[model samples]
Target: DQQVKQNSPSLSVQEGRISILNCDYTNSMFDYFLWYKKYPAEGPTFLISISSIKDKNEDGRFTVFLNKSAKHLSLHIVPSQPGDSAVYFCAAALNTGFQKLVFGTGTRLLVSP
Candidate 1:
């Protein structure tokens, strides 16, 4: 079974603080990892991604780290802002022709002023 798990359903943090979201996976065949951010009533937008061959990837305020041995991954948001309050989903997929992605239920992040 392909299951991506996000253990924390929600998180709250002060503005300019760091926010960390965690994810775990059961399928060992997943080779591509992705993170998507969603606002209310909007589709998820790709935030960052990493291939299984890499341990870490970063883009400005966001960074993702993968531990292949443990089948775990995490997203880190630095100096989070009030606008950053939204749901985040961690997804994984195999680089096959199907191109279907398995997504976690999602974690809601609240950044206070």
Candidate 2:
């Protein structure tokens, strides 16, 4: 079973517009959530994270929201730039020290100029 799922495989948006990516999870043990942005040839970089205890978290133009009851989450990018075009992965951890994260397949975000 897919512990995490990104229903949309890709999203395209114009530059300076908002890009929204959605994710859903079936595991209730997950307590820490993270979003990673990845480029073509490099590893994913930690973009933002939200703990299950909190409803939302933000950094710069990136924001993440967690809904524990619904087992869903989303990442929002405001005024997305061309540089923001890449693959985004939604991941979750159980809050244990090991933090074995489960990742979604990934969503490709294309920001056109």
Candidate 3:
């Protein structure tokens, strides 16, 4: 079974600091990894992603790092603000054939002012 795990259920960070969310997967065959942020009643919105062939991908305030050998990945948010507080999910899937996304339990981030 392909399992993605986020051991931490929640995290608290002071505003204007950096927040790092971690995720580990059991499937080495997974080719794609993604992160999403969700608010109270709204659906999850895509954050960032990294391909298996690449180790890191950065976009604006978000950066995703993939360690293929460890089957681990992490998302880093710099200068976290109160508005950045939300539930974040980590997902992994194959990019070929019938692609199916397997999601982690989710980590809720609290950016405190």
Candidate 4:
């Protein structure tokens, strides 16, 4: 069974608006959260990450929030631009030390002008 899943396969938003992506994990052992952005023919690039100890972590226009009690995490992008359109993947791990990660299928985000 997939431990991490993104229920919404796609999302659309207008330029300069906020976009929200969600992820859920079945494994309670997960204590680290990571978000990645991937473009066509390109490898997924790390966007942001959060430790289970913290409720939220923000970097520029990207923000990641974790709810340990609910086993859920979400990514928020403010003022999304057309260039921001890409596939977003969320991964869960026990800690950042190891390379093992359970990744969600991915959510395609489209930003329109």
Sort order, lDDT high to low: 2, 1, 4, 3
Off by over 4 Å in 3: none
lDDT digits (tens) for residues 19-54 of candidate 4: 999999998889888999999999999999998899
User: Which sections of candidate 2 miss by over 4 Å?
Assistant: none
Q: Residue by residue across 1-113, what tens digits does model 1's lDDT show?
A: 53999999999999999999999999999999999999999999999999999999999999999999999999999989999999999999987967799999899999999
Our tally of clashes for model 1 stands at 0
- What's the residue-level lDDT of 13 in candidate 1? 95
Q: Which ten residues in a row have the lowest lDDT in candidate 3?
A: 92-101
Using lDDT as the yardstick, the better of models 2 and 4 is 2
The TM-scores, one per candidate, come to: 0.96, 0.97, 0.95, 0.96
Question: What residue pairs clash in candidate 1, if any at all?
Answer: none
Give the top-scoring candidate (TM-score). Answer: 2
- Global lDDT for candidate 4? 0.95
Cα error of candidate 4 at position 91, Å: 0.4
Worst 10-residue lDDT window, candidate 4? 93-102
Taking all chains together, the TM-score of candidate 1 against the true structure is: 0.96
lDDT of 4 at 110: 99
User: Candidate 1: misplaced stretches above 4 Å?
Assistant: none
The CA root-mean-square deviation of candidate 2, after full C-alpha superposition on the true structure, stands at 0.7
Clashing pairs in 2: none
True lDDT of residue 43, candidate 3: 95
Q: Quick one: ranking by TM-score, best first?
A: 2, 4, 1, 3
